[model samples]
Target: MNEMKEAVGNWREAKQFSPADENDFLRWLDKADTEEKLFSRLTFWFTFRGLPADQNQRYHLVQERARELRLWNGLELKLRRWQDRVADEYEQIGKEAFAARIGEDYADYINSLTDPEAAPQQAAPEPETAKPAGVQAWSARELSEMVLPPIRHVVEGLLPMGMGVLVAKPKLGKSWMVLDLCLAVAQGEPFLGFPTQQHGTLYLALEDGKSRMQTRLRRLLEGRPAPANMHVMFQAQRLGEGLLEMLGEYLDANPDIHLVCIDTLSKIKPKAKPFENAYDADYDYMGRLKAFADSRGICVLLVHHTRKSKNPEDSFDNINGSTGILGAADFTIVLDKQSRMDDEAGFLLTGRDIEQCERVIRFDKARCRWVMQGTAAQLAAQRRVAEYEAEPIVKTLRVLLQQGDGTWSGYSKNLMEMGQRYAHTELAPNLQMLSKRIQELQPMLWERDTIRYWYNSNGNAGRKHNFRQERADNNASVPVSAQLSLRHNYH
Candidate 1:
């Protein structure tokens, strides 16, 4: 209600100038020296509303004074009502537009209007939870008590809440990649073939301003709708000053935020290494970030850099830090490209809850996002498949088939449902569109009456070879072409 009143006051002030007569009357009213002078102007500013039924003598006396003053009582009433009507319409239109912008259901928005005074306001929306103020410890005796809650991931089993670091060499599209992750989580969209939990993200791009961030984000979004959950700030305070307090206030305003990314920790980190050990100073800086996340149970991703090393046995060794930065974090992700000129790279992921796994990912120049294929060795063997050039629907079908050995058969409608597994863009329109896509895949199909459905890939042939032998051993007469090739290389 306070927010609404503030907005209304602003509206009144701005629109007061719209009506020329109101502006003239208001300017004079402000200059009035006393209550008598201000009240004299009101007779010309508004009509006196009093009736013989009025019990109050003050109301009758005011009307009598207005009649004696020969003020524009009739015209004043007309202008005030006109201004109010215009303001009312404008407010209604603004509310409708705002509701539509964030995809709020229109019916739900209407129901909320029933009790405007009772409606909760989100100055900065964040999830609300109550916590025990005092901490105590008890010896855990049961497995259930000791087990951690189901892990919540920002990048599904890859990144979770706590002080974490994402290290990559300079000019390696680290910003682009993190922005993609932030936007994906904001929209509940997929990132690198994995599902993401939707939540608001605060991206502090301390180095780059709006123009650079805008162009980079535009490329990442690729004409998609912007996510309301994602916010970007171009500046931030340094640690140990007001930075920690500023972060706390922001989280208080936006309590639901799951991910807070600070690009290039070097930018905002204190320059003086006050501690004795190299690791200690680094840990001291990150320790503040970890404490912040721990208090809120949220994720803090500190983007850092990797120093050039002579082929370190482990990628984690390449991170440009001593034990302080490394030990301070709950998780760390290292993206290392063999060459600065190439987009292909290996993503090394390690965390307390996750297995240390390496994934093969390549930058898609067209989409400006990394495409996760498989382990480096697996991707090396399948380079000839050309999965990158395949249509989204076909590419999705190919992955489904490659996952198992069977005749994966489905109708056109089913194909659309399956294709959504890899959907990063708008959903396919209908069954007809999906059927047309299948026809374009050049798959082995059953078309005795009409194209019932079918798919096949080179990878599927190897896995399905055993299936064919079993059929042949049974003396089955079904044609091999009719086999639903789950391993169909739609790529």
Candidate 2:
């Protein structure tokens, strides 16, 4: 009965009470109840009884009356508590979704942001792109079309990282020298004065037998131990077929190999016209070789030959055929002998990356080896000796000229006087010997004289060693008499 009465009272209040006024009413009720507890009980009954009859307004009025009576305060606190519980549940669901879509680390980062104690969030790192495997297919046309890398001198400076070709005439010990270089590199020894960086080396000698290679290697080593990192391939005939294919696999298996020497390029490249239009064929072969080296960061040393040219000075320019060969090579080294059968006399070592210099090495026939005998130091010593031997003769000649109106009549007394002043304790053979040495030095003096005459010569004869009447064009007339006075006779 009290419930019914309370409901009826709420409905009635709903018709007359505004939402804002209800709170005031509730405050009044509380005060009223302070005076009379029964007053508070009666107020609840009246609030329910005055509820609005309209469905929309009925709920609104009930809420209003509850507020007027202070009943809604407790209800609102309960509702807020329920809402917070649902929010926490939804937040966890969002985190799980993020974890599935991206990654766990991302989810954790996002979750941390909501926490008051979490640090400032950072951006995720970018993923790396995968590189393609195996050698990239490059046409000779492609390489030819692109600009070339700058040429670098080998021994002169840092040998730029790339492939190299060593070309020489037949029977020039090209193979022996290349093998020597490989052994030197493997052992971390110096090669032809160029420092060798420690590296694993692979030598493919198609022409030499295993036994012969061993013997030659022993000779080259000359009691020196072979570097353990060095590897040799005696299967020259098999190289033509699928050699590159196997090489690709071998390099993959052995990443440490830094140098590869192919004794002769002709052995590997497919048969083609030696002197005809084989640019395409040649380019393809070199392209493959270059690709192999570039892919593995290995230096490919290719042995090659020169065409039979009468011009002895022609080195790189005389390479067998197809300028494409030298064009493709990163470095080109040419081994040339100054004269035939004078191997001991000296050999010229010139290359794109090395300064052109000649060094004399002796061939120890007994041991079948070539050893460094005339290095820069050794040559410098020899030069000092020659200069010492020739000095007395030059001094004697100068003194003789100074004594006798700038010309010596005979060589004997002049030689004796020169020997006394400048020669070592034991002088050179005779005046003939000194004369020969002087003759050798004449061209050098002539060159110096030309420069001196250009600088010193004036129209006045007083400033010149020798003067002739000027022609109409102002050019000095050639001296007729070989004997000329040194002292200038001024006008």
Candidate 3:
């Protein structure tokens, strides 16, 4: 394969923002104090290059592409910022004026340069073709009436009605974690801090027999009534061994089941045929599983492994197989250990329709469940220092935001006041500490007016903490799962 080129052109090519101040660019773009101003800044992105003729090419679509590119903050905003610095007379005239005058000529230059931020456009159009099988266009009202994916919080954003994977190195207790998930869904109990929806859950213990599974369950249930809804299969037939048929028939029998877990990928992995491609085999297996999940609106959790050199920065990079398997799945959840021995660990959750998260966890031998220990910062990563250090304060605000209509608006002073009330301080913290905490939780926090706002993506947190309520702290136990706000920052 040829080495991939940058979207614009080259790295050292003509540019607006210097590489020296990229961090400053991100911080500046995100520093808006109000929602109106933030949206205004957002508008600048489209205005610079005329908004896309196709609606899908507009702000949201391009922004999604930026995330895929890992541009840090808002993609268009960053691009616009760069343009402001680089475009001739950008500061003297204005972005709209400069962009209109330059347009594709600028792209022509970038085509010759190395700008990774550049978005490539096709010169020649492909012939129009009929939509693929079962793919139908949606009418406006049909789309409006259709349930979009975010009616969420099945285990509070970890499990949903599409494909997802849970990965960890061997002996990191991934099985215990997933077994806890299945057991939680089966019994309508909480998984970690998140509430379970009480559904029949299938656990394909492909790597373990019934006896071992029984032992694990006893440890999890700990004398509580075993959820009859929980179903277990000691071993699974290989992919071509009627696995799909058997699983489909089982779902047919138990229509209420919405979750199926495969303990480890290797067990049920089909043997490769002569001349078969490894990537194809991996992707094909996952596609079959994903199809089953999507067809029935069920959740499938595939337990897999991470390679030795796990990328703490991006969990997807550490997955042990071809990129095709990742392409086939909806998202991934990766668990990693600081050391091979029983030590501190963290799990990174990233995928389509799931809010990205990485958090510290400790396994409790007595309860046989992972406890929310802290943020991944405890594992000693230096990036995103604020999120790492002020995780508790950020989570408190997350709970507060979710208690109301999943949003809040307040001046910095008001926010600090609220933070002080919720802060689990042994000695009352200063305004600076509280203010610093709010500032650090930026990805989850937004500004709209003179007021700053934030929300929980799962949609069911912090309603009781409405800023308009003139609310008192109610003196609760720090918003744990048992306390309220399952989606609150457990880390």
Candidate 4:
């Protein structure tokens, strides 16, 4: 009951500006001296229940105030700001009202609001048609008819326009990764072997000092001219205080900007209210950022850290927050490094607009940039081939196959003895070991040498092995020893 009374009291206080007269509102605006204060007051005015109910009147008053403050140029933006605030207010009010309605008579509550005789001081509101609210759905036909633009990527086909989180452990070159990305986008250069769409970029390097940032920038630039379209800031306001406003103003001034990177999400994350669910808070915070970026057709990359304990099975689980953080983002990239001393790292990318892929990248110490090696699958294939070719047992089998004119058949024991006698290479310690080694090399042998191997176990006799070339190849004429040397050098 006390909560309901407080809500009514607040509603009445908010109604002070809802009247037709502009004199009192103008007087109130006069007190907001600074630009931030002006924006804050305008936000507060639009958020409460009792601003002019007529949309046009509300806009007119806001326009007049903006014009007086030399903010007339952003009238449309201010209107959007108003709409967003009203939507938020509606949601919050609905939640509170739902909680207040428990054990209360709904018809009595409606009667109290509608009964002008009971409250003589309040004038009756004019009746207006109820508008649709709450969740909305679209039919397939409606969706099909809409011609939405393709998702534009900052790094073409990799980083699309929307909010994304890039998570890595501390001191793992995550900052350098984003810094390089910003430079590439600003200069229209390729990033990590992928083509980029050039445009303006902003890097909020809140944790780094000017000197450190300068040093890193110089290292990356390599004496090249600095990008004029790239902007950096060492400080920023926290979210809900003035951060969104600050970013929006900058974006408004620079219409070409397609990417904004916030170094360390902790710098601008809003504090949670008492008893708030962590997931709800995280989702709401990130959703606001995603909405802002999506509306402008730009990408906001949030640099963040992973948890101390890693989740080997799922890289997304290592992100340093509730699932809501990743759930709200349009995409996520997790950087994993096997060792602090290793130069190579794995980037696991998954999102709505990009395919799930793992890219192998190596840090270039000279330029302080990450160089793309290839996809993880490609690297793994190459590693397997190298390991296969270097095996002594593989060399013996290759020589035997070459001398036998690409055909050899025998039991595991016979093949092992032949390897020791002719090729002078121990195939394996025993018959069972030799059979296991042959099985392990089966795939590599077929792929590299076209030699197919199969076991022929006669029921009454014994198990025998058969090896034959799938087809004739040019490597048949090349000496086996010479081929081995050439393959080693090639790798």
Give the best candidate by TM-score. Answer: 4
Candidate 4 lDDT tens digits, 1-491: 34434443333333322321233344444433334445444544444313132223445545554554455676667667756775666577664453233212222232344564532232222234122332234456645754444556889878988899999999999999999999999999999989998888999999899999999999999999999999999999988999988987787567677799999999999987899999999999999888788656578999999999988899889999899999999999998988888999998899988988899999999889999999988999989989887877777777788888777878877887887876688878877888778877877787898776666666755667777775645344534643453354334
Candidate 1 clashing pairs, residues 3+ apart or interchain: 126-255, 126-256, 127-256, 401-486, 407-484, 456-488, 457-488, 457-489, 460-487
Ten residues in sequence with the least summed lDDT for candidate 4: 101-110
Q: Give the TM-score of candidate 3.
A: 0.49
Error of 3 at 410 (Å): 44
- Shift in Å, residue 46, candidate 4: 27
Model 2 weakest lDDT span, ten residues long: 448-457
lDDT tens digits, residue span 67-133, model 3: 3233436545655675466545556876544443333333333343455344334223223422343
Candidate 2 versus the native: TM-score? 0.49
Estimate candidate 3's alpha-carbon lDDT, on a 0 to 1 scale: 0.59
- Global Cα lDDT for candidate 4: 0.73
TM-score of 4: 0.62
The deviation in Å at residue 138 for candidate 4 is 6.7
Which pairs clash in the backbone of model 4? none
Off by over 4 Å in 4: 1-142, 338-342, 408-432, 454-467, 473-491
> Sorted by lDDT, highest first, which candidate order results?
4, 1, 3, 2
